[model samples]
Target: MDHYSFDQLPHAVSELHQKLDSIQDLLLESRQPVPQTIELMTISQAAEFLNLSVQTLYGKVCHREIPVSKKGKRLYFYKSELEEWIKSGKKKTMSELREQLPSLVVGRKGRRH
Candidate 1:
């Protein structure tokens, strides 16, 4: 280890203090609670959240086309699951498909040349 001269002690202390402050900020940030909360909604609320009419939502539920939970006679929807359901219906663009083609070709075996 290098020895610090007397005049350098204050500068070294200030540098150490700044490092400690940065570490403390990181520690405090990691200790904070996550903000994800499970939100359950009724059929009507789910319809409004998805911007669909109640009748359309019912049709989707009857056809088992959307994520849902049935408890007794009432139906429930989780906002997170609904969000995922919407994402699952997304269509890939041509550029996305092209980007994936190389990986797709690499995974295949026994190709005829």
Candidate 2:
């Protein structure tokens, strides 16, 4: 048999209510629709994000140099995709390449010159 003193009753009930409220909140949140984390930007918004003129952005889009999405007559860009596109063109400077040459020249399969 479980023994409950008067003082324990209020504490147990309060704890139970708090746990039930937490469960209810979790259920409600689960039923709601989640918003997308990656927001799609309009052409003008994309240009502003990239610090480019709208015309320059359009030209890049026309040349397939930039990532874009087309819906009917409009264009859209994902900020995440644009960031990746920008990173794709990253190149090491000449000095950096020169610094790496000695290590690359070592461990050669052919005879050293």
Provide C-alpha RMSD values for all models, in order.
5.8, 6.7
Model 1 C-alpha lDDT per residue in residues 16-100, reported as the tens digit of each score: 8999999999999999999988999999999999999999999999999999999999999999999999999999999999999
lDDT of each: 0.96, 0.94
lDDT of 2 by residue, 1-113 (tens): 56779989998889889999999999999999988698899999999999999999999999999999999999999999999999989998999999998887885756657
In model 2, state the lDDT of residue 98. Answer: 97
Question: What's the CA error at residue 13 for candidate 2, in Å?
Answer: 18
Cα distance off (Å), candidate 1, residue 109: 6.7
Model 1 collision count: 0
lDDT of candidate 2 at residue 68, scale 0 to 100 = 99
TM-score of each: 0.68, 0.55
Prediction 1 global C-alpha lDDT? 0.96
